[model samples]
Target: MKLSPRMQFLVRNGLKGFLWLTVLLAAYFLFREVVITHKPDAWVERFYARPMIIYLIYCFSEFFFGLIPPELFMIWAINKGDTWHYLFNLSLFAGISYLMGYINFLIGGFFYKNETFTNLKRRLLKDSASQVKKYGIFLIIVAALTPLPWSGVSLLVGSAGYPSKRFLKYALFRLLRFAVYGYIVYQTHQI
Candidate 1:
């Protein structure tokens, strides 16, 4: 039997999802070069002197569709400053990254609105709306902490028009997640 339109769309989206995952993995391998070379000091000298631009770029990267290696450039920034400055820089990076999560959320929401996706949600997310309303904040925090790809969640929130106040609160928690993970990485790597 021939696949229906919905089935075809699902197949296409599944392929797209696989492609996206491959791209993310390949990007990480590409970044391994920079990590291996270890140009931390040079970057420190460059960005530490001009943090504003760096921060803006960081935010822009996270806001757009950029894969974060968590430390491609952040390590340099951290070591370039005083301890507090390091923390501040890390926090700034996290804040921008968390905001970018909203971009992801929007994308997911858009996909959710698609004819195929809408049908999928109607069938799968039978209680998603009510559950979202009740425990959205908790879910956001969990997604943020775990490497569950939060941008999609953010996109869903954006598309659903989830309350802005709650979104922001959830976003702050997401930002804090960066700090938490970064500190762990920094300590473990001693970088």
Candidate 2:
């Protein structure tokens, strides 16, 4: 059976996310094995020692088009070797990301009619805006669940004057993405 265009888009993006994760894990393991003569625990400790700094960087990255892949943070959390700590970190990461997206949405709405903001939105989200117009909530769902720019999509939705209530409801899927991806990263770390 032929898939609809929306399904195709989703499938393509899903594969991209999977491949990206695979490559990231492989590179990390290779570096660990070949370059790090010392126990990774030392390195992990050095970074984990500054939890607040890591979280601040993550919050910035999530707000600005997710500049960093969250899976890396998950690996850092897993390295602590404490299940509760890992879970707590993952929850914090997800919460921070969700909050950033909501903030971007409000920013978009607040600047809805500003010419400068509109120009910037058109330039940054040219294709995404069209996709948002075409796919409506489905595109938001895809962005939330996949590696698509979650903040950008949220901005587009808000600037387009989509209902805030519905956006919040759909954006909750961001948590599921974190849960699933965090679980995968944790399991791989075990291996």
Candidate 3:
């Protein structure tokens, strides 16, 4: 059976996400084995020492187009090797990321008519805007689950006047992404 265009898109992006995850985990293993072996405790200590700073950076990244991948944070939590604490931190990270996306959506709606924002939307979302319009909330699901810029897509959806209720419903998949990735990272760390 032939897959529909949407299904093809989803399959292609899903494979990309899986590939990216594999590369990330491999890099993490190389770094941990080669570099961190010398001072493992020291590195983990520093991460634990400045919890607020790390969280703040994560918040900023999530709000500003996901500058850093969330998997890195999951790796950090895995380094600590406290399952319950890691789960708690993962939840917090997902919450903060979700909140940031919502904030960006609100900002996009409130400033949709502003010249500066219009220019930004044009420049930053040149391709994404068209995709979002074509795919509707399916694109939102893609962004939430894959490596796409979640905040940018959220902003575009809001500026395009998509309903808030539907957006919220679709965006809940973001949490599932976190949970799945967190579990994978945790399991990978075991190896």
In the predicted model 1, the residue pairs found to clash are 104-151, 104-155, 105-154, 105-155, 105-156, 106-155
> 82 in model 3: Cα distance from truth in Å?
2.8
Q: Predict model 1's lDDT versus the native.
A: 0.63
TM-score of each: 0.55, 0.80, 0.82
* Cα lDDT, all candidates: 0.63, 0.82, 0.83
Cα lDDT tens digits for candidate 2, 1-191: 99998888777777776676677668878877876646866776678789888888899899998888787788878976588889999999999989999999887777767788778887886776567666757767878887778888787788876778888998999999999999888877784
Q: What lDDT tens digits, residue by residue, belong to model 3 across residues 140-178?
A: 788899878889889878886567888899999999999
lDDT of 3 at 101: 90
Top of the candidates by lDDT? 3
Steric collisions counted per model: 6, 0, 0
- The full ranking of all candidates by TM-score, starting with the best, is 3, 2, 1
Evaluate model 2: give its TM-score.
0.80
